[model samples]
Target: MREVAFIKQNKEKWLEFEQAIFGNLKKNPDDLASLYIHLVNDLSYAQTYYPKSKTVVYLNHLASQTYQKIYKTKREDTNKLIYFFKTEVPLLVYQYRRYVLYAFLIFGILTAIGVISARNDDTFVRLILGDSYVNMSLENIKDGNPVAVYKSGSNWGSFVGITFNNLRVGALSYFFGIFLGFGTFYILIINCIKIGTFQYLFYKENVFWESVRGIWIHGSMEIFAMVIEAAAGFALGASILFPNTFSRLNSFKIGFKNTFKIFLSTMPFTLMAGFLEGFITRYSIDMPHFLSVFIILSTLSAISYYYLIYPFKVHKKINLKNT
Candidate 1:
């Protein structure tokens, strides 16, 4: 069938679904579920036959909204917390996956610029990292403990302080998106450049391996969570910039709800990173090389899987159930 014909046939049903979704009309859970299943079938048909048609897009959007409505109606009976992490956030992440990619690409570019700038200009590291930090790191390198910075405070104190600081940074990275995402970009620029510059300093001192072993034991999850936070911010910003079929206010509301879930998901990983930095990173200097590598890889893999791989898995599972 032609796309126009397909849309014409389904248009009335889609409108009624939208009215139930967006209007003041309240729907019963079972009725909503029935409608949702019907909408999903239409969406599947449109995707297969109409492919790139706006009808498919419209049907898909309606199906998603209907699914949410069904979930909301059933929320009273479900374990909300488990349902949140297990299903809601992952769906939101998959839906806005592009923002994550954009955040990482921007971070990569800024980091590269930092590395290139530091490589060409001897003073660039000091300018970015500050003279005091450079001198302290140089002294640490001379003393054969390139990451001794993590050893300064008591473990408990360090954990609390580091965790609080990381939380604050993540919050800023996300809330700053209100400025249409430039504020979030600014946050990423500051941190990513510092990362590049800091890593370059160790490389310049010929202690790259030492720094990696020491820093990355916790830095892996810590850094990855920060990037995810930035992605959340970008998603928030994009809502304002491209409201699409939504009013700017409604778009921002939906964007904030979904993106905030993504931001909230990073909290556990951030805390874990702080714990490693406080207790484990201090031992990285003398720890077995294999052990350090394992910790680094494990933390990185766990966080990466949750944000990247697990979302896809959850999305697939949900889609299968809908089918």
Candidate 2:
């Protein structure tokens, strides 16, 4: 379409947006998000087809202001944070549910590979888990305390260190999506393989049940958070690789914005895992079998409901909202 025609088409909508911005704000945030998405689409087309025209410049400025209004700006209050997790995040999780499934699928497949490889070769575990780790586990097994490794560090130190490290790994996985998501996949593969081989080693030592009761007291949340991080990364990479109707930059903007929230969603779970591993896992074997099972199942159920089931409910409610 001609530049004049384009300007004529969107000029009134832009004027309305200008009015909304300068006047009292009344639109629902979700409604504003829809407007921002359409505005971005228009801005992207203008940049592509009429880069030298005033229309392009005008749209660019308008889009920038709208983005600031919709995403970057918010009323200052505690409810803002609550609304973020309670509403904004769950909806995005529902929107990108496929990426979460893809991440889980990749982790599952590679985990199977790790188990198969380790079972087929004695050296495979050592190769993947490193000689030191394998030897330490063997020594621990010989000492009749196969899960003593969690006892190495002070509980508080371990709590702080583990939480920081988990967040770092999660953040790295999310950021690596900048490399077209391949980097994130590599991290996910490495992590899944580590879990597989390590567990298989416990199995080989005839401590499979004991290992499960000890490890999964914390591993449920820890491993699940890592998988969610991989989902965030994959979501980012998918956005870049398949911008669909939006321009590459605009798609990326949406991807990063939403996935960053998804990444944030993993934080409380990561901290919970860290706390359990530090304060609880060291004594897991000493606890009653029923208690161990209870803890593990409870953690799994919480994560499953939050990341999987709850998002659907939140999405449904948001759709039914009058706005």
Predicted structure with the largest TM-score when compared to the true one: 1
Candidate lDDT values, in order: 0.89, 0.85
How does candidate 2 score on lDDT? 0.85
lDDT of 1 by residue, 56-138 (tens): 76676667667877887787767888888887878788888989999889989999999999999999999999999999999
Q: Model 2, stretches more than 4 Å misplaced?
A: 1-78
The Cα RMSD of model 1 versus the native structure comes to 1.8
Worst window of 10 by summed lDDT in candidate 1? 56-65
The alpha-carbon deviation from the true structure for residue 202 of candidate 1, after best TM-score superposition, in angstroms, is 0.3
Model 1, residue 218: distance off in Å is 1.0
For candidate 1, the lDDT comes to: 0.89
User: How do the residues 100-189 of candidate 2 rate in per-residue lDDT, one tens digit apiece?
Assistant: 999999999999888998999999999998999989989988998789999989999999998999989999898998788999999988
Best-matching candidate per lDDT: 1
